[model samples]
Target: MASFEVKGGNKLNGTIVPQGAKNEALQIISAVLLTAEEVTVSNIPDILDVNLLIELLEDMGVKVSRPSRDTCIFKADAVDADYLASEAFRNKGGKLRGSVMVAGPMLARFKKAFIPKPGGDKIGRRRLDTHIIGFEKLGAQFDYHDEEGFFQLSSPRLKGTFMLLDEPSVTGTANIVMAATLAEGTTTIYNAACEPYVQQLCKMLNSMGARISGIGSNLLTIEGVTALGGTSHRMLPDMIEVGSFIGMAAMTQSEITIKGAGVEHLGVIPDKFRQLGIQLEIRGDDIYIPAQEKYEITTFLDGSVLTVYDHPWPGFTPDLLSIMLVVATQAVGSVLIHQKMFESRLFFVDKLLDMGAQIILCDPHRATVIGLGRKHKLRGITMSSPDIRAGQALLIAALSAEGTSIIQNIEQIDRGYQYIDERLRQLGAEIRRL
Candidate 1:
């Protein structure tokens, strides 16, 4: 169990490159099961979840070799064994919720797939019902056992049809797209998640002979193909990390540049942050944040309070709401933050309150942050991470505080960000991984 001890009140002033997206890399690696040829993925992050997923791929008979620390070459030509029945596969696969993505490609290519209950942040009831429903809409039959805690999907030939997802669940949408790419007919998915991660997955599938249209829209049209071939693909830069860096720069009053930021992929990130008076400059593919002593929250025209909320794609991403909430704590105005996705996500605001943040927890889904506007500085204290995003929020708060702070349960942070401490340290943050 690694922990981070951060000595705060340091202005991080340097340039840092963000790593590849963890969410997208998981799906891209899982897509290897759809082809028998060798697939090489570059810019892979050396994180715990990625390593575990690679182990799961190898256990299924795929030959995984790492020519470099951050590059992986995978060949699924010999993956003839059943992946779901192995305990080693089940145990490690259950560690991260992204493991559910394997159900689509495995079932599409091999005619059946067995997956146990997936594990991830215990934020709320993240039901697998959406995924199973999507598969069933495509003519696949599911036999789920509650006591055994295993789900089995079998289909002779998947006949694609119109699927209207109940909600825009990210992983559920990706699973269906992967399955539909190799189905027997045209598959139309409405209300599909159009996040950058899903878009990258579609682009990667297209490069391998799958015909998918509406790459950046909610309606996805996938034309089924007989089979797919292997191709090399690079994962997109992490947008969540970019947002995190923006928050870090603002909190520490540092001037930092983030390299390889996919500017086109950030639909509403810059403008959303602008609402908080955070200025950003896009220099080709990089984002530059200048040093600022203080920032103010922009208000509505009627002189009413402004609220930052999360919605589906093109709207603000729910994943970055925590970082934005923490950023709001230091801005020079008052704003209401509504986390509409999960119930327990806003519960971590208590820790920030302990650090002298002026936060009013309206309820489980809302919080009002009253910024001190540089007048008040958060003091350092020991804290524990509750989830991935909240862990990141706490780290940002710790970096801007005055004194030393210890963050325990850092494994939660490791599940998402790769080499977080090292990267922050490079940006002049006094963070040590203990």
Candidate 2:
């Protein structure tokens, strides 16, 4: 139950580097279990969820070596498949949603995978039906025990085949792709999630001798191979963090530069911020957001209200919608913030409204933010974080508020961002973690 005592009203001014992609690191690190050879990955975000998953891997007897702060080499030659069924895994693996991804590699290499019900942010119902059905289509059998809350999967030499996912679940696509890579035949996946995270996973798998085509598209083709070897891969810059910084800069009237942002991999993210009338300059690989008194929300061409919503890749990511909603509170005009992916994420607007922001909570999935238009500054208040993305949005709001704010349950924030308070301190933000 750690809390943050934030003294707001100070504009940040400095250069900060975005951490490695947390979502991508989860999928990429889980793929290490697919082969016995050494696989090295760099640019891993030092976060709680990732460390928990790594500990889960080590508990299953994978040799993990950390040569640097952001580098890890995994040797799964002695992986303990039996450990997946043990009580230790049931207790520990259930803590992280990323732990579910280990099922893909475990089933591919050991022909068996077991997991208790996974735990993560309670933003919405994150179902595993996509992952389960995908595996069943690839010659695997699935069984679940409702009373015990565990899923069991086994395959006697999986043979790849064509499958269409009901939704482009990011984790589902990663799981099926990893399983299909070592199967006996070819696999074609339609309606797959093609986020930069998934695309990077496909590239990393290909570097390890898995033949996968269509790197950045919803349809992926994979040719099975007998085995995969070791390869080194680096994670892309966290687009969520990049978008969060963009929102923070505009909300707090700060001049900040994000270093090593991987601009090309971030599709539609910068443009979406620009739609909020935030001016961003792309200087090489970095993104520079200049201080502004007030940014205006752009109206549609027909002079209608601006709408910001999430979609699959090539559209704005859902992870940043919370941040965008907070930024809209200070913008010069009204805008609609629609979080289509998660039903309850928009409920945090109640906290923002308590802080003096004008917002109408239309429903579980939508919020209409009427910007104070810089006519009134948001006052700080005590709040608790509900989820990772919402926690970050609150942090940004607190930083831009008129007085001190205390945020409890910051462990939710630590689950994703790496040393967030320390990083924000480098940018002259007044945030203290307790």
Candidate 3:
């Protein structure tokens, strides 16, 4: 129950580097189990969720060594099969949503896997239907035990087949792709998630001797290989962190530069912030955001109210919607934030309302925020983090508020963000971990 004592009303000014992508780290690290050779992964984020995933691997008998702070060399040659069925595994694996990814590599290599009902955010129902159905299509059988709260999956040998996913789930697609790599025949996946994280996994698999095509497309083709070999992979800069920093700069009226933000991979993210009238310049690979007294939200071409909604890849990501909602509080106009992916993600608006932001919670999926135009500064208040994204949004709000603010349950923030308070302090922010 760690808390943060954030003193508001200070503008930040410095350059900060974004950490490795958390979503990609989960997939790439899980893919290591597909091969017995050593895989060297670089630029991993030193975050709570990622560290937990790494510890889970170590407990499963994967030999892991860190040559540097941001790199890990993993050898999964001696993975313990019995450990996956132990109670210790259930308790540790169930706490992390990323643990479900190991099931694919396990079932592919060892012919069996135990998947506990995974948990992470409390935002809404994150169903495993996509993962289960995809695995069944690949000649795997599974049984769910309601009493034990786990799914037992086994397959003597995997035979690849075609699957048109009901939804393009990122984790589901990554899981299925890893399984297909070791199957007997070629597998074709239609309507697959083409997020950068999924694409990175596919690329890393290809480098490990798996034949995968359609790197950045909705359709993927995987040609089964007898065995995979080791390779090195470097994660892309975390786009979520980039978007969060952009929002923080706007809300706090700070002059900050984000170093090596992977601008090319950040599709529609910078434009989405620009829609809120936040000005940012692309200086090579760095994003420079200038301080401003006020930023105005833009309207549609038809002069209609601007509505920002989440969609699949090439569209705006749903994870950053919380940051967008928080940034709009001090903008010059109103905007509707529609979180189409998750139902309960918008529930954090109550905290903003308490902070003196003019917001109307339309429903569980949508919120309308009326910008105060910065005429009245937001006042600090005590709050608890509900989830990772919402916690970062609240921290930004607290940094821009008038007085001191206390944020409890900062473990939620630590889950995705690496050394957030330390990095913020480098940018002249007044934040202390309590």
Q: Give the best candidate by lDDT.
A: 3
Q: What are the per-residue Cα lDDT tens digits for candidate 3 across 222-303?
A: 9998999999999999999999999999999999999999999999999999999999999999999999889999999999
Cα lDDT of model 1 by residue, 120-194, tens digit: 887777888888999998889988777767888899989889988999888899999999999999999999999
Task: Give the TM-score comparing model 2 with the true structure, all chains together.
Answer: 0.99
Error of 3 at 127 (Å): 0.2
Q: How much lDDT does candidate 1 score? A: 0.90
Candidate 1's TM-score reads 0.98
**Can you tell me which runs of candidate 3 are displaced by over 4 Å?**
none
Give all TM-scores, in the order shown.
Answer: 0.98, 0.99, 0.99
Computed on alpha carbons, the lDDT of every model, listed in order, comes to: 0.90, 0.94, 0.95
Question: Clashing residue pairs, candidate 1?
Answer: none
Question: Model 1: residues >4 Å from true position, as ranges?
Answer: none
